[model samples]
Target: MEAIYIDKHYNLVVECKQGSRKACYELYRLYSKAMLNVAFRIVGNIGEAEDVLQEAFLDAFNKLKDFRQETTFGLWLKQIVVNRSINLLRKRRLELIELEGDHLENIPEEESEDEDDVQYQVAVVKEGIKELPDGYRVVLSLYLLEGYDHEEISQILNISENTSRTQFLRAKRKLMEILKRKGPAS
Candidate 1:
C-alpha cells in the first residue's frame, strides 16, 4: 500500500498545472517565505538565498507537469530550494573534505557541555552558524536545521557517510565554542 499525502493545496496545484496564473501566484505566495528560509539556511546569504528562491520557483513552475504529487507541494519546493542553494554554494567553491576511515575513530572526544545549562538567543545562534566554514555550516544546517540524517546528507552532498558524520561532529563542537564565547543570553 502506498502512503497518500493529504495536501490541502491540491486544487491550487492542479490549477497551476493547467496554467492558471492566479493559482501559480497563490502557490508561490503561500510557499515563498518558508522556501526562502530553507534557501537562506543552506546558502547562508540573504541575497544569494533570494536569487536561489527565484530560480527555484521558476524551475518548479517550469516542471509542474512533471510533479507526481507523491508528497506535498511544500516538500517538493523545499527539495528544489535546497538543491538550488547547494548549487549556488558549489559555484562559490564550497569544499567538503573527505575523512579517512580510521581518522574519525582516532580523534579524541571533547567533554560534552550541558546545553540545557546555557541559553542562546536566536540571532546569536544564527551568527555562530554563519561563522562556520562553508562545509561545516552546510552539513550542520542540512543535518540539524533541515532534518536530514548523515546518510541523506552524504547522498545530498556527494560525500561519504563517515565524512558527513565527521563534519557534523566538528560543526557541533565549533558551534558550541562560538556559543560559549558568546556566553549565555542575558
Candidate 2:
C-alpha cells in the first residue's frame, strides 16, 4: 500500500520536474502539512516554519533537475525543507557550536530525568525544548523528534558523530533543568 502511494508520488515528481504546475501543486498538497511540522520542530515558530516551507518548495522546484533518484522523492523533499530551515536559522546568526573537550559532563543515555514521575504536559516539554540553545535544540529535535541517529545527525549538521552524541546528551540535561524549574504537575 505504501509502495503504491510512493509510486503515485513518483509520477507526480516526474511531471513536476517537467514544469507542470498542476503536478507541483499536487505534490505540495501531499507534502506541505508534514513538511511544515518538520520545519516548525526545528525553527520553533509557525511563521518561520511557513516561510521555510515556501522557500524550500521554491528551492526544490528550481532544483528539480538536479535531483537524482538515489533516494525517494519524498525524502529528497524532506532534505530540502530541513536544510532550508537550518539555513534560515544560520542566516539569523545562530551558529551550532561544538563544545570542546571537558565542557560537557558525561551522562549516560538511560539516565533520563524520569519523565513519568512528573505527570507533566507535553506542552511543558515542548516549551523547554524551545528554550534550549540553537545547537542543542537542532540536535535534540533531529534526534529525539525526527528519529535520526547520531551518525545521521552528524551528516545533516556537518558535525562529528561524537559531537552529535555529546550535544544531544547535553540537550537532554538542559531540558531536564528547564522541566525541573517548571516543577511537576500539581
Candidate 3:
C-alpha cells in the first residue's frame, strides 16, 4: 500500500489557493490566537489588536498567491500581522520620544532598583507593560517579546537603532519601577 500524503502546509495552501473558505477559516483558527497576542502587545488594546488581526487575515487570505513559501506560512502570516499592528500604532501617531540625555549610558543591563527586591508576577508584568507609553511599549514588545533585533525594530518603527536600544533600556527601567510600586509577587 502507498503511504498516505500528509503535507498539512502544502494541502492547506492548495485549499486556500483554490478559494476554499473553510480552509481560510481553518488557517485563521490555527493562527489567530498567537497573532492576537503579538498584535495586542504592540497596540496595547484588545479592540485595536483584533482589528489588526482581522485586517492581517484579510490580506493573508487574499494574497495567498503571493506566499511563495520562502518562509513558513506561520512566519509569513506573522509578518503581516506585525506590520498591521505597527500600522495601527502609526495611525495613532505613535511618537518615539528621544531620551532626555539621562545618564543611562552606563546603567548595567540587568541591574534594577535593589535587585534583591525584584520579584515579577505575570499579572504585574502585563499591567506594567500596558502602563508604558506607546513608544517604549512598542519598542519593548517588538524587541523582547516579538524577537526582533534592534536593527529590525529600528526599521519597523522607523527609528534609529540607538533610539530603539535606548527605548528598550528606558522601558526596562520603567517596568522595574512599576513592579516595585506594585510590591513583591504574591
Candidate 4:
C-alpha cells in the first residue's frame, strides 16, 4: 500500500505556481525561519545561511511549476537550502577527509561526566555545535538534527558511509568536551 502525504500548504503552492505574488510571499514567510535554521546549522555562519535561504527561495519560486508535490513544499525547499549551503561551503574549499582505522583512534574521546552533574541548556548546546569544526558540524547536523542516515550523508558529502559514521562519532565526542567545559548550568 502506498502512503498518502498531505500537504497543509497545497493551496499556497498552487497559487504560487499560478504567479500569485501574495502566495509566493506567504510561502516564504511560512518557511524562511525554519529553513534559515537548517542552512545556518549546516553552513555555520548566519550571513552565509541567509544567502543560502534567499537563493533557495528564489530557486524554489522559479521552479514552482515543475514541483510535483510528492512531498510537502517545506521538504522540497529544505533540499534546495541544504544543497545551496553545501555549495557555499565548497566554495570555501571545505574538505571532508576520509578516516582510516588508525586516524580514528587519534581522535580523543571525552571523559563521561557524572550523571548527577549532567545539565543541559539549549543555548549551551547551540554554542557547542557552533564550536565544532565545519565537517563535524555538517555531519552531526545532517544526521542528528536533519534526520538523515549515514548513507544519505555519505551521498550528500560525496564520502564513504564509514567516513560519515566516523565524522558523526568524532563530532559527538567533541561536542561533549565543549559542553563539559561549560559547567553544570552553563
Count clashing residue pairs per candidate: 0, 0, 0, 0
Runs off by more than 4 Å, candidate 2: 1-6, 103-120
Model 4 alpha-carbon drift over 4 Å, by segment:
1-4, 102-120
**For every model shown, what is its TM-score relative to the native structure?**
0.88, 0.81, 0.85, 0.87
TM-score of 4: 0.87
Ranking, lDDT, top scorer first: 4, 1, 3, 2
Residue-level lDDT tens digits of model 4 in 1-186: 544468999999999999999999999999999999999999999998999999999999999988988788899899999999988988988898888672444446345465543434666789999999999999999998999999999998899999998999898889888988987662
Which residue segments of model 3 deviate by more than 4 Å? Answer: 1-8, 98-120
What is the C-alpha local distance difference test score of candidate 3?
A: 0.85
Rank candidates by TM-score, best first.
1, 4, 3, 2
Evaluation by TM-score, superior candidate among 1 and 4: 1
List clashing residue pairs in candidate 2.
none
lDDT of each: 0.88, 0.84, 0.85, 0.89
| lDDT accuracy of residue 81 in candidate 1 | 94
Task: Identify the leading candidate in terms of TM-score.
Answer: 1
lDDT measured at residue 120 in model 1 versus the true structure, 0 to 100: 40
